[model samples]
Target: MSQATCPQCHAPFTPGQRFCPNCGKQISSTGEGVIPTVAASNSSLPPTMAANSNEGLPPTMAAGSNPNLPPVGNSNPNLPPTMAAEDPANHQQPYSQYASGAYTPPPPPSYNGYPGGTPTPNDPYAPPPPPGPGMYSMPPIPPKKKNSLPWIIGAVVVVLVLAVCGGSLYGITQLFSKKSTDNKTQTTTDNNNNGDNSNDTATKSVTLTNLAISYATDQITFTSIEQADQFPDDTYTKTYSYEKKSNFVRIHMKEKQEGGRSAYFSYSSAFSLILPDKTTIKALNAGEFSGPKEGEQRENWVDFETKKPVDLNSLVLRLGTAEEAQMEFPLKSNADLSEYLPKQADLNKAFNYGPMKWTLNTAIQRYDAPGAQAKKGKVFVIVSLTASNPSSSDFWGYDYIRLKSGDTTAAPEYTSDDDDLNDLSAGASNVKGTLIFQVPPSDTYTLVFASGKNLSGTNVTFSIK
Candidate 1:
């Protein structure tokens, strides 16, 4: 008379009953006749109760149970055709057949040729169907993303930026370089122009056309200029003597006043002579000359001496400290003397002055003289000259004459023992005299005559050999 519990609903029932009356699930019994306690509902059952219940249950019941199993006669048509034809109601015969002890449970259905043990009506342990071609699988993992495009874009942007910066830098450098080059070129051009201007300033030329002479505070007029190779007898050396003799270049000039006032000129410190070599020669002796009256012009002479002969074609005469010259003259030299002394026969001819005619008669060598003694290494030479004045004015014979042999020159000697051609008054017929010079005994000599004291007049030369 013990009770058994229905496994699906946990309802109590008599042990001899084949099924539970409340839920209509089948029940089983063993030969032991042991009663089975009613279990709590499976939803509320403790883990110990569930495990203990498995111990006493049959192997078919212990495997599993299914709550969604079809009823005994209601098999699913969606199952396999073979499984759908097997009726579960056929296995549930009346319980009176099981009471005879000869009834046995049906074998479990075979799944793919594997024998499943005897199955309970609603077994939960049915093996799942084998996987077919329609089974779901995880989506293919997405390919790893690539970053090549972004890197390329970034590199391109960087290159463009660098190009722009480099262009800007190049432009700036080129601008500065061009500016510096222009500045240097301008500086060089300015320096060259300055150099050219300086050269032009240093080298300047002026012509000598109608130049006026100046002395101190007075303005003078330059009339004429001449040159001679010797000094006059009474002017420089009174006796025939040996000294450093030089040639003379003379200037004939005059000064004028607005009114009748007289002007004085110092010949020595007043003027200077610039030779062709640009050397300046100052006057050795200082003397004064008087100016002319208001309308009448008086003549004055200034003399400059040089040890060597110069370019007689061009000479520069400067007065005081002036950078510009007072006068320039085209003087004459021995090369230009052929116009006056045409031939050697003309040396003794009467050459006409403005109001006088003069001639060189003869030259004689004298070894000794009465009272005039020649210096140790020297001898004397006598020259005869004649002068005639036909005009009303007096012919003054105070002129420079000399005898030249090579670079040596001797002035005339004034001696009381010889006939001297002094000043001839107006209406004088003719006068003759002999002039003497002490010189070294050479094979050749030249007698040079100066018409004026400054040695600047009609000059004549006679070769004496």
Candidate 2:
């Protein structure tokens, strides 16, 4: 029997043993008489085994052949041809032939110590065992997606922007609505105020009893009022030419000073007459005069002329300032004119009016002058008067004196070469002057002297027969 090494455990074994007692690998006698030659360069076999068989060895233990071992004779003629031996001194096995055998591994035997069958070299056809726990790890769980904080932040920003824009639009709308409402309210209020003012202006009335009379800074009291009317007469037609005929109303008022100051009144543009129909007539002419010194009273007159006859009962007189505190006098025109006309007086007797006295010296009618002819259908009436001012104060001659004949009245004509009776000083006596008047020839006439320019005051009439 030959002693051989167990290729699996490298332990000594008898040649006839079929399996190694140490590693439990199979041992074969078919290797007998086969040279333990190195495998060919292209063959996958162990170097320690012959090329035809690796019967006693495991695949991992096969390396180089040991030439010191004695060669055994061949006992099987059917074996494949062996590699020729080389000289022992220089012999080398190729590194590629080491552990390069094509041997099939056997199935592993059961083992009580391990959980499953142990793998062997000859078990190439066996399926791999299932992997034990913890041997493989699941693919690293993809890290959970981090919370989408950026997306959340972007959404919040968009929402805030929309909210801000919407709020601004809403605020603007409210502001405009409020402004429009305010404007409408103001307009309504203004209209109401205007309506009220109009109502107030339309209903107010002023009257003579309640006439506002003021002098300087003090209010004055009205003492008496006198008025008269003058119609066109034959003398007026013969002496004066007019495109439009008119009637004259003379208004006179005596105002007493209530305060301790002399009051002066001016009649320029300060008079207007409101007719029954509410038509207003401005003064045709005005005159100015001063009232008596404090507590004394004097009369002044204002004249107005109109083409249409006025209803004196409904007439309203406005005097003084054109603005505030205008004096209003409502008059009655039913007074008899004969009561105010003077009675006929002799030419030699003196006639007295206020502080002045007058005497009619002569009356004559002439149709021609020294160098000028009298106007056709007209005659000149020349009257000589002697006036005396007995009062201490100067007397202003009445410029409104006239001559009346039937329905005619004639104003004095100053065109004659006669001295005018204007200002007369105190204590003056026998101031003689001639007053000339043009009139139509008449059978009867009266020489009249008025106190003031409107012919409203005392009148002295001298009958010329």
Candidate 3:
């Protein structure tokens, strides 16, 4: 009951039948010519057969050689025609289906009639299809992002802040130092100007313009006062101020040459300071004109206007030589001792004294303290003495006193017994005593005494001058 298809008669035949039942054409068992005739029906059969048949085989006889095959030119009756509505002639065409805008998905194309293989060697220009939506893919690579503006801005801000702070600090420091220097300069200028105004009385109401104070000593020898100027008025013009205090004007006269060298003189000249009221303050007398010498002397004159003895707050002095006109006064380095001490003895001693001792403060003894200044030759001294009384008798005796030159506790040029009235009525009365020492301008003097009994107190404390 084998079934087959007739080649020419288009009739069915039993199995092993070698003849066409309808056309009576001989049928060969080789089955080769039968495939060529079937493939001839349409050349597009190759693509269809190539699409579904096994790889690398003749499609016709392979698919149609079945014993229960249908007649030639017959389609599969069981399969719906719409399932493969695509024309088989479209096979072997390049992009024909896609170019037509058809929605049908093309089969996976191959070569050599094999699965997942290359194109046929016979086709020269055959290349694979272009990439599709899902066909082509690449590894995912995320984008890169970078930002540095914030850090850069912050660094700029920091630099600006530091610069501002440093500049501000430096400016403040400079400003303070400048103000201090200006203040000092202004003060010095004001003082010098005031002193200059006080110097010239004729220019009193003239509003003193030149503000320079000059000084010269009497020890220097020069032909003229104008030629003896060491510190010229042109060099230092800065002014100075004076405090409100009593001052006796001190004058130092000296002689020198115009070239700054000291000179010896055979005779001296008279000098004085003329005030605004035509009152003359005599500086040097003709008796003092023996030789070229330098001497410092102070005047105890009271201001005619103030009626108080001038305690030397400021002075305007001038010196004249035999040949030259005059020169401004110069400043001296000597300390003002009048304000410090008010006694003639103390002043003289300060100018001519030595080391001293302190019984109370041992360390202060080695140094000398000028005693005091006296007004109208009156001086005060504070002394201390210690004594013992061993006998029960009240003796009538007095203590001896000495006034020595200089500050040493040595033998003095003047001595006197204590002028105490005798009180001889008790069993040793211990009493404290104080004495006053008056001396002229000898420039050096001190009070001392020998140890004796009946020395009452440990100290003799009182003011002198």
Candidate 4:
């Protein structure tokens, strides 16, 4: 709104005027150039500002404003005046675009460091330049994820090893301890019995017979002697029943028999038993069985005069009807009597020792229908040993018993005879005196036992556990 004098040409012009009309020089705030200076006045000027102040000049003369003008006193006044150069408004300042460029941007105002172009000189809330990228570098990468699997595996392995070792040690300790304890118990038992003459209740005697009847052992008793001198070779009798249905024998003791107390008794005796088929079985050695001889019958006679190993394969004891049972136990009496007499060899074959003790072992063999070929669920009668003889006497003597109906010859595996009544045997006996049999599932059985001339009857009973 005002004009000032140009220092070079003494000419006045407005503030935006870049060159003086009379001379050539740049205008400055100091008014030291030929450019026109603005003058303050009350004069009303148009509010529109033209980008080129040269709009006031003719286009031809506008180009001539760039001037390193000669002095205003030059004689040639016909030439258009050259003015001083001025800054162009539309030109871009390259350095101003980037903060790092050569040009420095004006500092933000003092308050909060926000751009106000110029600072409030006394503002108290101004801040420094905002934090730079340098302050925000990423924190270093976190440590790799910690893996605990290896530690867990190691701990488990250690625990397993410890457990295995502990188990092995414990097993070894127990093994040794058990062996020592067994030896100690045996020693103590022997020491206590050193001079004792009383018979051991555990050591009992049992008589054996061949009866084809299924019978269950309810109670059994055996009598044992401390020495052979106490063994009695006396004649005795017992009753038993041969089951008609199961073809098994059930044995019972005679009330008059001294050893007949309940179903158990004690005795020490050995004898050779022979069947009707001439199957000579040694009932002496406690562990020997005799195989069926030629033409052997099922359950006929138990000769106490023959001692031979009995092979179970040679024997036949089958479940059959009462009518069929007779086929197995045919009644055959020797009219000549001398024809069936036992020989000296038979007497020698009698039980090797006497006054021996034995324990009975009874168990269920089979329980099925009645018939030589019956299905399951049918029952068989169980037969028990009623009496037996231990004397090695007359050669002509033989044992006789009645298996009136159901009867089965004892397998060699289930026969035994002990040598010393009060002492242990040399080996374990597979020959068990006690027998187990299954009768009709819901029925009972009966049998009988007797003595031969070569052996005296010693009544005794047996039972199941």
* TM-score of each model, in listed order: 0.23, 0.24, 0.21, 0.23
How do the residues 270-345 of candidate 1 rate in per-residue lDDT, one tens digit apiece?
4788877788887644224433334444555676776655544356665532331133333322212221111122
Residue 50's lDDT in candidate 3: 34
Off by more than 4 A, model 4: 1-49, 54-140, 185-465
For residue 358, give model 2's deviation from the true position in Å.
0.7
**Count of backbone collisions in candidate 1:** 0
lDDT (CA) per prediction: 0.51, 0.51, 0.34, 0.30
On TM-score, the candidate that comes out on top is: 2
Model 3 lDDT at residue 397: 46
Q: List candidate 1 stretches off by more than 4 Å.
A: 1-348, 416-420, 451-456
How well is each residue in 262-295 modelled by candidate 3, as lDDT tens digits? 2232222324544334354544223233332223
Error of 2 at 10 (Å): 99
Steric clashes per prediction: 0, 14, 49, 64
Kindly report which residue stretches of model 3 are placed more than 4 angstroms away from their true locations once superposed. 1-68, 74-145, 194-465
Query: How should the candidates be ordered by TM-score, best one leading?
Result: 2, 1, 4, 3
Q: Runs in model 2 with CA error above 4 Å?
A: 1-346, 417-420, 453-465
TM-score preference between candidates 1 and 3, better one: 1
lDDT per residue (tens digit) for residues 261-341 in model 4:
121111112122234365633322211122122222222112122122222112322212332221122111111222111
Worst 10 residues of 3 by lDDT: 360-369
